[model samples]
Target: MISALNRLVDLVEDHLVEEVDVDGLAKALGTTEYHLRRMFSSLAGMPLSEYVRRRRMTLAAADVVRGGDDLLGIAVRHGYGSAEAFGRAFRAVHGAGPGDVRRDGGPLLAQPRLRFRLTVEGSTPMRTRLVDRPAFRLVGHAARVPLVHRGVNPHIQRHIAGLPPEEHVRLKALGDAEPAGLLQVCDDVDPDAREGSELTYLHGVAVSGDTPTPGDLDAIEAPEGTWAVFRTDGPYPDALQSTWAATATEWFPSNPWRLRPGPSVVAVLDRADDFGTATCELWLPVEPA
Candidate 1:
């Protein structure tokens, strides 16, 4: 994975003036574009598209300063058709227009090339299992919520709170599958997994496909697939969120599987009255790498 990501970085640098085909590059590296973009965003601390733009602008600023060509020509060479389009991109990255930078030679934000490396550590282990689940319905009060990477997501909390208390009881009773409780489900997530992206957040439960859903409740039809389940016990949401991050950082890199598009389900095994601490089982859909 590290080698592939480094090669991808090299490819980006080699084709800064050209339209790099990410899907083809990912295919050449023996990975999917979805996984590649997701991993790049996770490790690079920015979206792949954003990195590409910044890298292009970083180099374009040099030509603007050197005075070899006009702003329109430089912008067109960098894949922008017009000076207006290129100026917007240039100002976004360098905080100054190309014309101003051409005269003043000031204000440049450079995004350095990315490199990925691995460090072997045998200190901790991840608890995981492979589950082949049949098709099940996720039934509950659903909401559109922005994605949050760490700590608690207050939007999810408020969404669940807005549901009638009895609805929670009803959802729990409906669950008869592997994740046997009121499940916290996130579906139709953006492949890049960008923070603040809106995702289908279902405070729901898994049920058999034949199970009937109430018209008032939102439902997500989850198809049968292989799942990677991780179990954790600690402070509510904090430990769970850490485990989630570790899957991309530690677990997936070392494993022979890659994430697939599906609803991520979290089943609460136990929790305190105030929801400060608990045990949780996180189910993520995946396939052979």
Candidate 2:
């Protein structure tokens, strides 16, 4: 996995002036584009697209400073059709437009080339299990929420808090399958997993496919697949969030499984009365790599 990610970085560098054929590169590397992009985003802390833009602008800055080519020519070479488009990308990355930088030869933010490496750090073992589930249904109140990488997501908190206490009991009672509790379901997520991207957040329960979904709830069909379940316990969401990060940085790289498209489910097995701590089971869909 580390080698594959390095190869992806190399591919990006070799095609900074052109469109990256991520799908083809992923196929050649024996992985899917979705898994590749997701892993890259998780480990690199930025989306693949964002990295490409920064790298492109990093090089484009040099040309602007050198004054060897007009802004339009440099923009065209960097895959932008017009100067305006290139200016937007440049300003986004460098915090200064091309024209301003060319005139003053001033501030420039350079994005260093990325290289992925693996380190040996397995002191604490992760408690995990693999489950093969048949088709199931996730039914509950659903909302579109922006993705937040770290800390508590107030939007999700507000969503859940808005519900009456009985609704939580009702959702738990509705669950009749594995991941057997009120589940935090994040579906239709962007493969890049970019921050601020909207995703379908379902505060619901899992039920067998044959089960009838209540008309009042939204339903998401979960196709038959295998899940990599990690059990976590500690401070509220911190432990759960760390386990999620570890799955990308440690588990996937070491295991033979790759992530597949599906909703990520979080089942809170136990928690403190004040909700300050929890024991959670995080289920992520995967397939043999």
Candidate 3:
């Protein structure tokens, strides 16, 4: 996985002035674009597209400082059709427009080319299990929410809090399959998993395939697949969030499994009365790599 990411970075560098063929590169590397992008965003702490933009602007700054070609020529050379488009990208990265930088030879924010490396840190083993689940239904109240990488997402908190207490009980009672509890589900997520990207957040539970979903609830068809389930216990959200980050940094690199397209489900097995701590089972769809 580390080698594949490094190759992806190299591919980006080679094609900075053209569209990146992520799908083709992923296929050549025996991986999916979805998994590759997700892993890149997770481990690199930024989306692949964001990295590309930063890298492009970093180089463009040089041309802006060294005067010879007009802004349009420099923009065209860097793949932007017009100076306006290039200026937007340039200002986004360097916090100064191309014209301003050219006039002053001033501030520049450089995003160095990325290189991925694997570090040995398996001292604490993750508690995990593999489950082959048949087609099932996730039924519940769902809303579009922005993705949050760390800490408790207040949007999700507000969603659940808005539900009547009895709704929670009702959802729990309706859960008749594995991941047997009120589940926190994220579906239709962006491949890059970019922070603040909108995703379908379903506060729901798992039900058998044959079960009929209540008309009042939203239903997501979960296709049959193998799942990698990780167990975590500690402070509310913090511990669960840490385990999620480690999955990309440690587990996936070490395991033979890779992520597949599906909603990630979190089932809370236990929790404190004040909701300060929890024992959670995070279920992620996967396939043999």
lDDT value, candidate 1, whole model: 0.87
Q: How do all models score by TM-score?
A: 0.93, 0.98, 0.99
What's model 3's lDDT at 84?
Answer: 98
- Angstrom error of the Cα, residue 183, model 2: value is 0.7
lDDT of 1 by residue, 55-150 (tens): 999989889999989889989889898999999999999999999999998788888888888978536788999999888888888899999988
Mind giving the per-residue lDDT tens digits that candidate 2 earns over 123-146?
899999999999999999999999
Misplaced by over 4 Å in model 1 are none
| Per-residue accuracy of model 3 over 113-213 as CA lDDT, tens digit each | 99999888979999999999999999999999999988989999999899999998999899899989889999999998989999999999999999989
lDDT of each: 0.87, 0.94, 0.94
Model 2 misplaced regions, further than 4 Å: none
Q: What are the candidates' C-alpha RMSDs?
A: 1.7, 0.9, 0.8
| lDDT, residue 212, model 2 | 90
After aligning candidate 3 to the native by TM-score, how far in Å is the CA of 285 from where it should be? 0.2
Q: Which residue pairs collide in model 2, if any?
A: none
Q: After TM-score superposition, what is the CA distance of residue 151 in candidate 1 from its true location, in Å?
A: 2.3
